[model samples]
Target: MNIRKKVIFSFVILVAFIISISSLSMITTYHMKENSSFAKQVSRLINIQEDMNELINLVTIENSLEKLKNIKEKFISFENDFELLREDITKKDHKDLIDYILPNIRQNQNISKSLNNLFENEHAIELIFDDIYKFQNKHIYHNDLFSKIYPEENEKRKLLQELIFKTTNLKLIQEFGNLRYYSKETLYQHRDMETFQKWTNSIDEIILELRKNDRLKILPLFTGYKETVEIMGNLAINIHNIEKEEKILTTKLIKILKENRDESSSIEIKIEEVAEQFLSKISFIELILVITIILITIALTLYISSKLTSIIQKLNSGVKRLKDGDYSSTIVIKEDKEFSEIATTFNNMAQNIEEHQNTLEEKIKLRTNELQGALVNIQKQKDILENLSNKLAKYLSPQLFESIFSGKQDVQIESKRKYLTVFFSDIKGFTDITDSVETETLTEILNEYLDIMSTVAIKHGGTIDKYIGDSIMVFFGDPLSNGKAQDAISCMNMAIQMKEEMSKLRIKWQKDGISKPFHIRMGINSGYCTVGNFGSKNRLDYTIIGGVVNLASRLESNARPDQILISSETYTLIKDTIKCTKKEELQIKGIAHPIQTYEVISSGNNSTIIEEQTGFNLILDLNQIDKNNIINILKNTIIDVEKNI
Candidate 1:
């Protein structure tokens, strides 16, 4: 057969095997379910057996009407459980097994009812005996009282008490109570009828004695004594009759229980036999079918493998020749049309391989020139990237530069409104200090200050937006944000660290022969502001602008020397984390309202309150602070202020 027919035949055989396995599994499942049902019924039967035994026990321990009532309730529950099990039997074999057990269940129910009757009758007999005993005791008391009142007949009263004690059947109730029965067999063998009859005879003898003795009748209490004897004797006979009936009923109940026990045993045996028979039959067939399927599968596998291997070997041989550079010859297969087409394709591939070999040198030369051109372009791009990287490092933070270079952030002058923590700090009395320092020393001091502040900003993940002469502007929560609160906290921490570093720088500058050292003041604010690259097409500035930014600058301009001032917005975000004292409000320019500020005290160190209250408002045109000649102008202002005072 061709490959298609071979594959089809193999598939058909596999499908047949799967169907066989499925059919076997279904048959096994059916038998398993049948066995499970049988087991369930047996389990229920066992429970009923335990209940019956418990009933017998209840009767033994209690000889009262109440215990008998409890026995009826328990028996009803047992019947319900058995009925449920019977309804659960759905399989034919399981139903047949239950058919045998159900009859016994019914019989057991009847037996339980009969036992209940026996218990009731026993209770009634005990009650009557109790009443007779109580009456006998009352009569003896009256007799004694009569004898005491009439002293002449005291000896006769004593003899009457003896006769009464000897004839009473009160002690017979103890014998009835001793009728021990703990199981069905014990109940069956008990001599209850004989015991009741002997009790009746003893009472009859007492009644005969009472009738024959005339002396007993002549006593003053003779009528009462005779009435008591008659009542006791009658109750004894009634108990004896009831005893006979209870014995008969108990015997029948025991008979039914035994039959039920036997029937239960038979059903269990039948279930075992049925389960064993079904399993053995199914297992035998399963084994045979499995062996047959294995054999068929192996035969088909060998047949298909042989056919496929022949074509594969031919194709493999041609592949090996191609691998060995034999491009002049091709393989030809004749077994099947499919193999023939493969051979044809293989031959065409060999012709193409030969033609490709002829132009291989020219292709290599062309590829070499292309690779050289790519290398030259790569070198030029590398040089351009190096220059760009160096320039970016000076202008942007390493993180922001990487983001822009990696194409994650664009270089376009696009801006967006975001909440950022803006920081502004400047050297206190910078102009006054600059006047005492040389130009070169001042340049050195300024560069050192900028470098130190910038280092702290980058370390705290802040972006240094710009430097305005002796002032620095930095903001966080842009391009990447650790959240607004975190950014504000980080900015505050950076400001604290910069203050500490500046103290050391001041000491170094003083040691380098500078007489006056400048202290830094910082201001921070956290609020919504527009931040991005914004400028002309030729030049762009990545900075933030808004009222919030202005507020930060105003806080810096108004801050006391060596103090860090934060706007209310920044203080609100870091209030729980940073310790700060509220500062007086400042009326900032270009704003409608006076802004609330807080001086960050004891955040990291002792931040002094150096800016004193002037008691009078001193308004100065801040525009007079020139970028180029701020020191000379600031000195002139100090002289003019002294003159005004």
Candidate 2:
């Protein structure tokens, strides 16, 4: 048969095995549950057996009517427990046991009720002693009065005294009290009818002797004594009867419990034996079925494995031939079984691969030459793009140019609020210089000066915003910053360096025959300003704007030539790193309040200008040396030099 039919047949057998195993498991589970339930019932019966034995003990040990009352409640509770037990006992053997135990339990309950009623009606056994004591006291009182009336030591008085201190009567009265019962146990201990008869006879003898004393008969106290003794005799006999009944019932209850215990043990053993036998049967059946399934599964696997091994070997031989460039090879299918379709498809694929091989080789040859030319063109385009990027860098500040090329900042018309230290500086007499000098010469000077200042600003990490005429605007704290304080300090240092550079340029210009060279005024301010690329998308300028920029420009206009002025905001930031003198507050345009200002001075690393020439050499740091002594010292040195010349 083909593989599909074989697989379908194998599935049918597996499903059959599954159904068989499941049915067996279900049956085993049902039987186990049955056995477990039977065990629980037996467990409950054993507990009832224990309770019944305990009830027998309660009846046997408890004889007092007061204690018997408590036992009466115990009897009721036991009855309740037994009734519940009876309902739960579904097993035939256990139910039979319950049937037997029920009648005996009822008998015990009746006995407890009888004991309770006996004490309730009879004022208990202590009343006998009380009656006897009252009779004895009356006899003593009357005997003494009779002896006083006669005043004679006679036989009659002697007999009356004999009755007063009667030993026989005292023994009868205190019998139960001496036994420490005086209640239910009084009758229990002396349960024999002979004991009651003895008590009665002793009372009869006392009355008989009292009748013999004619003088005592006339005494009212003597009559009362006789009647009291008679009442106690009756009370003792009645209490004895109640106690006898309790003992009989208790003995019967004990006998019944012993029988029930034996039955409980037998049932427990029988149930266990039955359970063991059932489990053994189930295990044996399951073992046989499991072995059958395993043997069948092994045979099925071997059949499929043998068929698969032969098919795979044949397919592998065909694949090896095809791999060795044997396109003419074809698989010869036998049995029309597994892998026949795969053999047909593999043959078709081999034919197609042979057909396309020549065309693929031709295409690869042509693509090789084409790819080389494209690579050369790609390299040329890359160099051209890099050169163009460098030219674009000239228009933007170095920081801004780097951000745009590095993909950190997007070139868009976007702006954000940032705290920047804005700087503005212009040549002191730029308009005069433009008119006095030739256009070519003036343009050269201006370019040279701008180049110097631009280098200083860029070196201090400022973004050169724009150059208006000879005026240059720059800002710090933009695309990147070392915080506001550092940005402000760097700007102040840049301004100071620019001022010093101007002094050097002045000397250079004098040598160039241009007597009055340019001086520059600079201003710096720190505050929140709008900074980013501003303008249309086609033409954008990465610069800053707002009131802080305007204030910086105003400070520059108000500054004196060769001076660097700054706002109070910038002063605070540069105070630690650079020396700045707080200046007078000035009211400027577009500002409601007076603007506080400061003059920039030397920094921590201030340098003195050292000028050396053919005729003069001057090295003076005004901040470091004594200025008052310098003028006379220079004069004396000049006079000595003049004599030598």
Tens-place lDDT per residue, model 1, 1-645, is 677888787889778877887777673564466556556765565566556555544443344455455665675565566556544542232234443422222223333343344334434433433433333334344434433433333343355445455444454333222321111112233324454444334444444544565434434454444344333334434444445544554565565556555555655665566666555655777788889888988988898788778888988988898889898777877777788898999999998998998799799999999999999999999999899889768877776787888898888889999999999999988988777788998999899989998999999999888888999999999878999898998998898878777877876776797766678988888899998889988888778899889888888889888899998888889887788998898888898888888988655333332221323212222334454585687689889989999
Task: Give lDDT tens digits, candidate 2, residues 466-562.
Answer: 9999999999999889899999988988998898887778777778978665779998889999998788969987888899999999999999988
Which pairs of residues collide in model 1? none
RMSD of each: 35.5, 42.0
Off by over 4 Å in 1: 1-323, 326-355, 372-376, 379-383, 406-408, 604-645
Model 1 RMSD, rounded to 1 decimal: 35.5
- Residue 198 CA displacement from its true place in model 1, Å: 75
Per-model CA lDDT versus the true structure = 0.67, 0.68
Q: Specify the highest-TM-score model's number.
A: 2
TM-score of 2: 0.50
Q: Where is model 2 more than 4 Å wrong at Cα?
A: 1-307, 337-341, 357-378, 406-419, 430-445, 479-485, 507-518, 526-537, 545-551, 572-577, 582-597, 604-645
Residue-level lDDT for 205 in candidate 2? 53
